[model samples]
Target: MKKFASLLAVALLALAAVSLGTHSKATAADKLPAQVQKIKDTGVLKVGVKQDVPNFGYYDSKSGKYTGMEVEIAKKIADELGVKVEYTAVTSQTREALLDNGQTDLTIATYTINDERKANYSISNPYYYDQVGFLVNKSDNINSPKDLDGKTIGVAQGSTTKTSLEEYAKSNNLHFKYMQLGSFPELAIALRAFRIDAFSVDKSILTGYVSKNNKILDQGFDTMEYGIAAKKSNDQLTNYINGLLAQWRKDGSLQKIYDKYNLDPADADDE
Candidate 1:
C-alpha cells in the first residue's frame, strides 16, 4: 500500500508540472508592452489590405480568401499575437484614413513610407522596395518616359506616382498631363480605352496588370519603399511589428514568402 501511494503522488506531481507549463504560455501576453497587450487582449487583429494588388494583397472572390506576400505578413502577425485576423480592403486614397479612424490596427496594403507620411503615422522600416514604371498599349510603341511627354498619364489618386513623375519630367525637360483615378483596374480600363497614354505605379504592381494588350516600359523611376503603417498613437504596436519584420528578414522567412510568388524585390529599385 505504501509503494502504490508513492507512485500516485509522483504521477500527480508530473501532471502539475505540465499544467504549470501551459499556464505560463497563456500568460505570455502579460509581459507584452501595454499597447501590444491591448491588441492581444482584443481577440482579433484588424488588418487593412488591398484587394486588387496581386502577389501583394489580393482577395479572390471565388476562393473567398486573401493571398499574397502582404496578406501572409498580416497572418504571421496575428499568429504571433495568438489572435484571429480580420481583413478590410483598402485603396491608396483610403488606407491612411482607415488608420486615422481606427478602422484598422495596421495597414499592410503596400503602403509606401515617405517623409510626409511618416510624420502622420508610425511607419516601419521598408519591407519591400519598388520603383515607378509605366504600362502602355502594345500598339502605341511607347518606348520610354520621354515618349509619353505631353501625353496623359494616369495614376492612383492618393499615390505619389504623379508627383514623382512630375519631378522626373521636369529634370528631363518633359511634361505630362495628369489624370487621377480611384483604383488600378480603373486606370487600366482607361488605358485600354486610350483615355490615358500610360498607366504608372509601382513596377511590381504594374507586373500584375501587364497583358498581351500592354507592355511595361524598360525604364522605371523613383525608388519606392513600402512599409507597414499604424496610427501615430500605436508606437508600441509598431515597435512590436518592427521586431517581427527584423526577425523575418534576418531568418530569410520573408524571402521564402517572396519566393513563393516568384517576386524579385531586388528589381524593385531599378532606375
Candidate 2:
C-alpha cells in the first residue's frame, strides 16, 4: 500500500509538470498571430511603411503607386528571403503599435530606434542615418535653425522632430512658436503658403521635399540615425533583418539605394 501511494504521487507530479509546460508554450504561442508565424512558416515577408513621406516612402501621384528608397529596400529584403512581399501603410504614431499588435511584420519607415523604443521593440541594424533638419522658404531669410528663434516653425504631429526641435529651442535659449501640422503634406502646403516660417523634419525628408519644390523651400537644420522596428520578442525576425542589412552595407546596395534618391549615404565609418 505504501509503495502504491508513492507511485501515485509521483505520477500526479509528473502530469502537473507536463500540463504547466504545455500551458506556458501555448501562452507564448498566443502572443503573435499565425500570420506572422506563417511568414516564418511559408517564408513570406510583410513590411509596414508610411505612404506619405516622399523619397523615403510615398505614393507617387503620377504613377499612383508606392515607390521610394525604403520601398526598394523592402523589395530587396523580400527577394533575399525568397518571399512575396506585402506592404501595409502606417502612420508615424501607429507604426510601432501596428508592429506590437502584430498587424505588420516589420516597419521600414524612418523609425528612429531609441532607448525608450528599445524597451518595447527590437530595432534592426541601422540601414540609414538621418538627423532632424529645418525646411524654410528661400526668401524667408532663415539660413539655419538659429534664425528661427522668434519665428513660427511647423512640424508634423507625433514626430521625433517635434521633440528634437523643442529640446533644441530650450537648450539654445531660443523662443520659436511651433505649429503642429497633421502630416508632411500639410506642413509643405503651410510652408509654401507662408503660413509658417519653416518646417522641420528628418534631413533626408527635408532634402526630398526641397528637391521636389526647390522653388519654394530649402534645407536648414540636422538631428539622429533611423532604423527599422520590430517586436522585441521576435528575435528570429530581428536577426534575419540585421543580417540582411549588414549584407547590403557590405555590397554597396544600401549606398546605391540612397544614391538613387540623391541622399548622402552613411556607413559604419560615419559618425
Cα lDDT computed for each candidate against the true fold = 0.91, 0.77
Among the numbered candidates, top TM-score falls to: 1
For candidate 1, the TM-score is 0.90
Looking at model 1, residue 165 earns an lDDT score of: 91
C-alpha lDDT of candidate 2 relative to the true structure: 0.77
- For residues 1-271, could you state the per-residue lDDT of candidate 2 as single tens digits? 9999999999999999999999998787565445345575676677898888878889777887778898898888777656788888877878888898878888999887677888888888788876666787777666666777899988887778777777778888998898997888898889888999988887678765674443323333343667878888886677777888898889999889988888874333442
State the weakest 10-residue window (summed lDDT) of model 1. Answer: 262-271
TM-scores of all candidate predictions against the true structure: 0.90, 0.79
Please list the residue runs of candidate 2 whose C-alpha ends up more than 4 Å from where it truly belongs after superposition: 1-38, 61-64, 211-222, 266-271
Q: How far does residue 191 in candidate 2 sit from its true spot (Å)?
A: 0.8
